[model samples]
Target: MTLEALERRRLGALIWREKRAEAPGKEPLLRAIAAFLRRHGLDMLEFPPALEALRARLQFVRRHEPDGGWPDWSESGILAGIEGILDGFLPERFSKNILKQIDFQAALKAQLTYDRRRRLDELAPEQLTLANGRSFRIDYSAENPVMAAKLQWFFGVRSHPALLHGQVPLTVQLLSPAGRPVQITTDLPGFWGGSYKLVRHELRGRYPKHDWPENP
Candidate 1:
């Protein structure tokens, strides 16, 4: 039967029980209940619980699969995982109804596909090549994405590398040959013209073996 018809039948049964208990003055109560059900329908009662359950499931997946590996689009697969979870929680008929209401597997597949397309392997390169031909691996797990390269590697670089269609600037940790961070800046030009002279002097005394270029 249609969902609306089922809901109306259920409401009628409930109102009939209420009327039997308090027969004298329940005409107004029954009329009001019927009017309210007709006006609002059953969406307010149905959708919130279903949405809350879906949200909880999504959160569980995220928490358990920080690496986006669960639902493993490549292995056991997203569709299988979604179907398994839904089937485990609901009866076969109910699960089929929910699946018809929302294409959970397709939604998850779209998300996984988008993630794959923009995966660090595809879009955000792990190692970025500098002007000096030196390459540094970017660490995306940090609060701000960071790249640690030797100060000399950024000698002629006037700006930090921009990623994600030039929307994100990498937090550069300029290091010495010994891998000690000498300076950290998102603005390469500002550091080169500003605090770099003092940093250069400190590094010159600390590591005289390394080239501390005056112009750089």
Candidate 2:
């Protein structure tokens, strides 16, 4: 028998809460209803980590550079955000099995207007270029947000990289020729003037074949 719209929604929310709290494998009908609830505005699942990381980058910018336009990630804020993004975009009825087909990243991106998205990319880019023109991904999940690359590539670098419009400094993890982590610092000039000399002296003996420039 077909349930009324309200009845389906109530059952869907209950089942969804239960499924998240415990084991999976609910009936197809219930799952369908739960998926329907999600498509609507009743979804209560925790935000996915990937989406959260994206939001974290935006939040980092907002926190450090408070003058920009960024979304609030609080419970009410996100519900409103989802509602706004999913507007006129949901189908009337779809199977629960296709729930995973939703492009959540796209939905999150939709929350930001084109200009803001462009601003976001500029302020917190996924990858950054080094002195040697090599691009490396930035780890936003790190305590201070780090970029790791071989020390040799930073030969001409005199200043540490900054993010969030220069409000935050990126922690750099320099690696050896063999990709072994050699040093971690946020001050490139300090390392080059002070510790780099000692490090160069030590590593040169161990890695005789690799050129460790004295001026780097």
Candidate 3:
């Protein structure tokens, strides 16, 4: 039977009670139920970092563009509507071992209409293209969105990129060859002209193979 039909009839609790009555003890039944819930991605354990970051980006867009049709991805909002989100997405008679393989993002995306889903991509892009045509992932988990990329990738880029239609400026984290943050700044032009000289001088000797141009 469909999950909706089951909920409408309140059969879940009834079935649990019947199972408990037939079972020797509560532990086995409880464990079975927990396993079932976990397998279905309904256990409400902490979401992975990427999923949480997506949610945070959605929230950022919602705050900046109140009139936009973005839906709330907050904990309360999700909990209230997760049943509807999962209604038709669940497979029938799935094995517990495959629980971890479920794509929660796909399920969440399914909940949004086509237009709002497209808007989500436009407002909170997963990656931004650099001057050298390299795309780096944006870290939306920060107070302000930040993009960390190797310094060489942004060689000709003079201005810092903005999000939410230029309302929010993105912080850039220039990384060394070792993937360490050599510099962090919102003003890319000033950084390029000023401290970049000293940075280039220091890092040139350290990472000789990597490009540390004088005019970067």
Candidate 4:
């Protein structure tokens, strides 16, 4: 079934359960709802523990995040991000209570996941320029931070042996020639790092005709 249709059916089934518990044929209905929720991105384990309380907490995070602006993060954003990792992937061996008790900020920094879209501020940038004043910059902006480091060698072009290159988000920017006018940063993975990434992204994105360091 389509994703929307599936979620709707699951919601109805769960709501019905709220109205009546252990009713006739409730078991089959619960099973079906569980399967649907899982297919639609809910974790199998988290699905049961969530109940109405957890759903509200999770939904609060979704609704509270104001798109196009900084998230209402001074309080719960870090908590929510870290919680998702535990709720979505941690095995049963790690009790949910452990997740609840952990310091949100410290726990949030466990590692970056390449499988997810990274926060814009958490991004890193690499730029490459040619002798002719052309430039290219790339950013590996995935939410998964750990994967970015592991995949660093993925975008290197064999020919640009000494070229300056780096990641900003999902994009990879590279420069050519040994003495290009490109710039990189030592402030990577922090506030200064974000500024560095943005600078290159804007410079390259605005001037796309340059022979950006390419694989060939």
| Best candidate, lDDT | 3
CA displacement after TM-score superposition, residue 165 of candidate 3 (Å): 2.7
Q: Can you rank all candidates by TM-score, best first? A: 2, 3, 1, 4
Question: Which clashing pairs does model 2 show?
Answer: none
Please write out the lDDT profile of model 3 over residues 92-146, one tens digit for every residue: 4443333344466777777678787677788788988766677889998877888
TM-scores for the candidates: 0.47, 0.70, 0.69, 0.18
Write the residue-wise lDDT of candidate 1 on 75-193 in tens digits. Answer: 22332343343332322232213323544443443554556534533345656777667778776555466888788888888767865545667899989889889888998888888
- C-alpha lDDT of all candidate models, in order: 0.56, 0.70, 0.71, 0.32
Worst ten-residue run, lDDT, model 2?
Answer: 1-10
Q: Give the per-residue lDDT digits (tens) of candidate 4, residues 81-132.
A: 4345333333233231432333333333334344322433222223344233
- Residue 207 in model 1: shift from native, Å? 0.7
Q: Which stretches of candidate 1 lie over 4 Å from their true place?
A: 1-111, 114-123
How many residue pairs clash in each candidate at the backbone level? 0, 0, 0, 24
Q: In model 2, what lDDT does residue 163 have?
A: 90
Residue 58 CA error for candidate 3 (Å)?
A: 1.5
Residue 175 in candidate 4 has what lDDT? 29
Model 1: how large is the Cα RMSD against the reference?
A: 14.8
Over the full model, what C-alpha lDDT does candidate 3 score relative to the true structure? Answer: 0.71
Residue-level error in angstroms, candidate 3, position 145: 1.9
- TM-score, model 4 to reference: 0.18
